[model samples]
Target: MEHIYLLALVGGGLIGLSATLLLYTLGRIAGICGITFSLFMPQITDKKWRITFILGLVSGAFLIHLLTPIAIPAAPTDNIYLLIIAGLLVGFGTQLGNGCTSGHGICGIARKSPRSIIATITFMAIGFITVFVLRHIWGVI
Candidate 1:
């Protein structure tokens, strides 16, 4: 139990530290969806930093797995189609919200943006409603 708390603390600290560093060094927000979407659209001036940031994210995850060997939580379902649908929905939702959870809930909120505050609240409410519908009404989760 204490290990779980320690892990959470460490994980959260890393997130905050990374976000702060990105802001101070690059004058950028550490938004995963925004970072990824930049690869698609034309005329991105600073592509290297975005690519490096993404690589660092992936490498960090791999390094953490190598070091700690934590067990990944099992998915709610094993169906490939279900996973695809969920992924697409998430992508669409992020675009609809103008940012993902990381942008709105973490970086934006930390910077005290009003739009981020409202967006985060809306998403969290919708998430709770969706979970209730899935777990209680439909028994999905």
Candidate 2:
């Protein structure tokens, strides 16, 4: 339990640190969705940094899995159609929100942006409702 808390703190600190560093160095927000979407557009300048940033995220996940992995159960569903729908929904929501949780919750909120605060709150509220409906109402946990 104590170890979990320690890891949480360390992880949060790293997130904040990374956000700060990106703002300082690149004059931009460390939003994963924005960075990732940039890769698809040919006209966008400075693609290298965005690619490196995304790669770093993937590398960090791999490192964590190698070092001290939390036990995540296998996903409950194997349906390809469901997965595709979920992915499309997520992509649409990201666009609608103008950013994902990392952008709004971590970088945006830290910088004290009102829009980020509202977006993060909305994300949390919607997430809670979705989980409640799926687990309790729909019995689909």
Candidate 3:
């Protein structure tokens, strides 16, 4: 239990450090959605860094899984349709919120952006309600 907390603290600190570094070096928020969206835009001049950042994220996870004893959990649902719908909903939510949790909860909040703060609160509340409804009311997980 103590180890979990320590790992979380270290992970959070790394996230903050990365966000700060990105903001300081690139004058851009380390928003994953924004970075991903930039990839589809041929006109975006700075795709290289975005690609590298995304690659780092993927490779880092793989490296951690290989190096650490921690066992990464699989997806909760194996249904392709459910997965697709969930992905679509998440994408839509990100679009509507103008950012994902990491962007709003971490970088945006760190920068004291009111929109990000509100967005984070709203999503967190909704997420809590969703889990309650799914787990308790609907008896689904």
Best by TM-score: 3
TM-score ranking, best first: 3, 1, 2
- By TM-score, the better pick of 1 and 3 is 3
Model 2 scores worst on lDDT over the 10 consecutive residues at 68-77
Worst 10 residues of 3 by lDDT: 73-82
Report the lDDT tens digits of candidate 1 across residue range 1-141: 698899999999899899999999989999999998888778887788999999999999888878887865665788788788889988888877889888988999998999999999998999899889988999866
| C-alpha lDDT score of every prediction, in listed order | 0.89, 0.86, 0.89
- Name the TM-score of candidate 2: 0.87
Task: Estimate candidate 1's RMSD in Å.
Answer: 1.7
The alpha-carbon RMSD values of the candidates against the true structure, listed in the order shown, are 1.7, 2.1, 1.5
Clashes of each: 0, 0, 0
